[model samples]
Target: MSSNDSDSWGAVASSYVQVERLTTPPCQTLVNRVSLLLPLNVPNTIAFDNGCGTGVLSAVLRQQYPRLPLLATDASHGMVNILRRRIEHRKWDEVRTRVVDSRNLEGIQDGSFTHVFSTFMVCLAPEPDKIVGEMQRVMKPGGVLGLAVWGDPQFGPFSTPWEKACRRLVPDYEAPMVMDAKWTFAASVEAGLVEAGFKDVVVWEEDVPWRWDDVEAVSKYYLEGNNPGNVGMIDAFKARGGDVEEVRPIFEGIIKEDCGQKDGSIELHAPATLATARK
Candidate 1:
């Protein structure tokens, strides 16, 4: 990952920790499905949670398999610190935290883990192919690899407003590519896993609905906190001489108009893909 990407994540680490509290249900569902698919009951089971932001999935795995040894890694040191803190607070000695890049995985030994999983992190990979290769490299011969990533943004109702707002407010504005190099599509994700020497690769779609009591809550968490692409869009607009704060009202108006308030709340469907394969 680039320094800019790392810096951006570092700046948002605290906010992301808070956002995950609200956004973890879908991720937890993915984690459960992945765990069910793996032969985790085998003797001497060891696991890895790559790109473990705030350790939500790690916590779930720990609860499900208390005896399993888990190593959680993230590219951002700030995220790693938060994960470590969470682990320490929970007194989970079985789980270890590390600051490591997803693509390189510098210090991890080959064929060291029985299962490897990453949630919502593949989208940020600078080179997703390299990351997939590393995940395969670090897992044992029969190990399971699972991942989740954002599906089409068009189906994401909460995201559409920010996307439309960026286009209208900033001239010639192009949204930053979060999942570059064909990693966004299900076919490509499956192909990447296969190329990395994984077997029985299965990629499937899931729709996770996120509900907020009010637009203010939506603006605070989804817009300003969870969605990094929206934040990047605002930054890009500002860079092009646009006043983002000054245009806040207009942006909110567009969102309310597009997403239609119902019963004093807003519901958004966040579509994602969950993939699992054996190495």
Candidate 2:
């Protein structure tokens, strides 16, 4: 998340698809927050879901506003494929999929969408300012650009253990995280939006729900599990010449020890920011 490059985001997003259960709440909530700024039921209210990893926002919009058309996009082919499969499974005829890097949405023409929303991706972009500019270029004159980022990311209890585990597996390895401190403040987000030529910018905080009902599945995904979209942890381990399966149990132990809760469930505090601006 620190690097302002597509590959870093791809890796981070690739892992996100594997953990959709805990992420769905925030994605849906962000959509709800952004809805207040932009009208969705109008016939001309076409939407763009930028950086739409696995099409979570698309699914939310489709379910809520059945008649609204959506263009869902992500830089990762694997993620787009997953979204394609979801579209196929859900029979969402109003939604289309594209594999486009958000920083350069060259495939799309100017003023193409009335509403553009990206959840959980703006801060991690290598060229966040450029992406905002591209958003401005693609949105209509009175269009709304709504996005969400972790405004002061709160790492889970297992974050320290996970970092230490990475060190144990990969010597002298500095752990790469998806939350960039630069875009973690609401004021920073508002300033960036205003600088990008967006007016009436609004930034507000929201608490994203982070909970895991099953620790075993969480542990498996944390390491080398069956998830093909597991480049975040698995690739980090592999790129460092370490075996992820060997350390799976260690993470499981750590999660159960630190993240375990009294109600027989695990939870983490997640604070986020939702930003909306008019282009």
Candidate 3:
């Protein structure tokens, strides 16, 4: 794939605007990560959530820390609108929504926040190092920065099959911007924190098992969920003499077989690494 093909992620933001992850109630994974790092009760500090997709995590954080000021941002106007609507109807207070790029929080002031958070976004950033620097810059010296990113693909049940299909479609396709769990082990997070003048970094992880009542349903949802990103992927498949429409059913069937269980539930592990560092 050419370098230009990589810039097609805007579709992801647009397509996932009304997705289930944001509309559903808080999940165990969300609760556990925040519970682990946050104090017994919510604090009265200013907080920021980068890539606040549909404001799911941001909503949960606001609930957990009602006394804190929250700023939720995304690179998508659609997502920002959805978040604003959701919050307005619920009357959540002191929470601002904006279409701010994570790579540089220029509109946000330096040392102005007591907490910073991001989920499943840092890895997708074009410049992760710059994003970390921005996070550090916007946080106070003793502030806590909490973030979560993709773990091992083998354990990320939803992503593994999707990634496999993408690879099969474009063998040479390499994701230069995607961050993986290995980044933490290789000091990518630690080094970035240090370079950004962060301190006392602590990282932890947990696996969230996502279960669907049927393999077919899970596979179908997965395909439908990620169909927006398939523009480039489908183009790659066609360029390789692959009939994407014809192959989609086969790919979906393969995913079902790969994830099926005898008890009528298809299970996949969605693991996330949680990290906290001080600025």
Candidate 4:
């Protein structure tokens, strides 16, 4: 991650609670899958959380294995800042926090950890292969490496209705390619891990019914989340001469119509792939 990337990530750290709330279940699922593949060796196993935004993955790690020690790191200083506070408040003494880019984990020596997990963040790295290499370098010879990335359908993180609004409002609006396309493929993920010297790699698909009880709240987040993506979206709408304020209602109306569930919650398909291997 570059300095600019750090700045952009930090800017969104506060609002990321929303993202975290929406993602925690999948975080739990990924950690649970890792635990099944590589049972922890108490007092011996040390884990690394690469690109641990707001410590969402770290929290799941702690919940699933309360005694496990962790070192959570991210390239964004802002993310590290918020995570530090969370650690202090949550009283997670076994977990340590650091600000380090996943692609270049300097000062972290080779074969330092028993297990390393990268949840959803590897895809955001500018050089994902380099990040995987760094992860492999720091992990013990038989250490487990678990990873998660969005799969299949495009824009799992964004509502499809939003895409519709963009295309209708801005004739040439193309969704930003935030995640590397190649990384989204299960084969690409397994191949990358194998090339990084990991063995027994396995990749599998998972999906969750992502739900929101309130349409207004979801629309509010889209309007005010201030994440780099949301900011860029509003900018695109304005740049294309659309009524900027109309975007929120468009998101709400379309989502309610398309994804609203029977229990009065909006549901969307959130597909992701998880991979596990030995280093």
Candidate 5:
């Protein structure tokens, strides 16, 4: 990812963390499953949480393995600040936060981590292979690496509407390209891990549901919030001579109508893929 992309995420660290906490079941699932898969009680175990936005997975991992050393890193300095604050508030002395790109984990020695994990990070990379290579490089032989990513956005509840809205508004717009085709499916993810020299790879897909009590809340997250994806959509809309203020209502209306509103709330099922492998 570019510095600008990291900066965009940094700008919305607070809101992004809030919304992700409520909406990202796949992330929680990755943490739970990886905890079960890895030998947390192993002596001298150290873990890396790459792209550790706001330290959500790091916090959970700390609770799971109180004595385990945790290093959380992100490209966004703003995200690292939130993570540092979280660590300070919780007094997790074993947990450390750093601002670093997942693609090039500078100053981190090879095979230094016994367990490496990332959630919703690899897919966002401009080059998923570089991130995977770094993850594999840092992981000790026989160590496990786990990651979660969005499945096909066409089948996703929240992403599909926005995708459709953008296409409708912008005549020449195309959905953002996937960093790796394998990132969108469980089997492909497994194959990619194997290709990266990981063994005993396991992958699965799930539909995680997110609920919002108000349409405006959804609008605020996608529009008002400093979400990089939405910001790009707004840019595309303007590039096509569409006014953001005018297009937002139309976009919200499409989302409300298509995303299945019930009892004054919107329920969205986000299709996600989770994968783990031993290096």
Candidate 6:
């Protein structure tokens, strides 16, 4: 990950505390899909949530399955600390949070978990293959692994323009090399689970449209969420004689024009896939 990406999360850590209200609903949608793929009855099962951002997803899981034993870990120490505090407040005795890089699970024992789950963190890594291998290594035989990846939402207003703008600006921008790095599973199958010897691989996609009532909200995500890895792209735009300050306004207008509705919310769509496989 680039400094911009790192800085964005560092900057937003305080604000993202109330994620349920500020962030959109696609998170829950992905979680629901994971829940569906889990075994019918998994009592007393040990689960691991890798790349567990602010711990919001893990916290939500605890709320849904109070008895589910979970170990939540993130690559970001800041995120782990916040999540630890959050889980502590939740009183989830079985929940343990830590900071661990996805590519290496050094301290985790083999076959320590019955199920492993992750969301939206694969593409940023230098090697998702290793991460998936580590995840599989930590799971008990017949244990399930659930992960969600962002699928290309070509039809989405925000995604369409941003992806287009990135190419128009930065010619050398490296998209993920993994087949599904852009959110399909070709790379994941080739570089991930299959390579790691996981069986019964299953993949499904869902499109969730985010409605932002405030233009500032859309601007924030653009300038914040996607901006870090996009500095090169942004600089390219600036070098082309585009007024950098005008970028935000232009994006806001685009959202207002395409996805915005009479209901005072701008619609942004995120298409993603929920993939599962058992070992």
lDDT of 1 at 219: 70
Error of 1 at 149 (Å): 0.9
TM-score of 6: 0.81
Q: What lDDT tens digits, residue by residue, belong to model 3 across residues 1-279?
A: 113322334445455643434222323354455456555255556778887777777777767666567899877666677789888998888789887777767678988887787776666456777777788888877778777665542333544565466566666543222344444332565665677787877666666556677766665554555533334344545666665555566666656778778887776655566677777
Best by lDDT: 4
Error of 5 at 187 (Å): 3.0
Clashes of 4: 0
Instruction: Give TM per candidate.
Output: 0.89, 0.79, 0.77, 0.92, 0.90, 0.81
After superposition, the stretches of candidate 1 with alpha carbons farther than 4 Å from their true spots are 21-23, 153-159, 167-174, 221-228
Comparison by lDDT, 2 against 3, better one? 2
lDDT of 6 by residue, 1-279 (tens): 344444455555665643334223545655565567664237757789888878766866776777888899877766777787777776779888776777888799999988788776665455667778889899888888777666642223344554444444455433322223533443544346676888888777777666676777777755665333344445545665655565566666666776778877776766666677888
Each candidate's clash count: 0, 3, 0, 0, 0, 3
Better of 1 and 6 by lDDT: 1
Residue-wise lDDT of candidate 5 within 65-97, one digit each (tens)? Answer: 888899999999988999898888889999988
Q: What is the lDDT, from 0 to 100, of the residue 243 in candidate 6?
A: 56
Model 3 misplaced stretches (Cα beyond 4 Å): 1-44, 152-187, 222-235
Overall local distance difference test of candidate 4: 0.80
**Clashing residue pairs found in predicted model 5:** none
- lDDT (10s digit) by residue, model 1, range 1-279: 776676668778887754475447766776677778876656888989998887778877877777788999988888888888888888898888888878899989999998898887776568888888899999999888878877763334544676576667675765555455356668887887888899999898777776667777777664567356666656766777777666666667776776546676766667777788997
Error of 3 at 43 (Å): 6.3
Each model's C-alpha lDDT?
0.75, 0.73, 0.63, 0.80, 0.78, 0.65
> Alpha-carbon error at 2 in model 4, in Å?
1.3
List the RMSD of every prediction in angstroms: 2.5, 4.3, 4.5, 2.0, 2.3, 4.1
Distance from true position, residue 33, model 6, in Å?
5.0
Task: Write one digit per residue (lDDT tens) for candidate 2, span 179-239.
Answer: 5565668888888888889999988887665677767757655554433223454566667
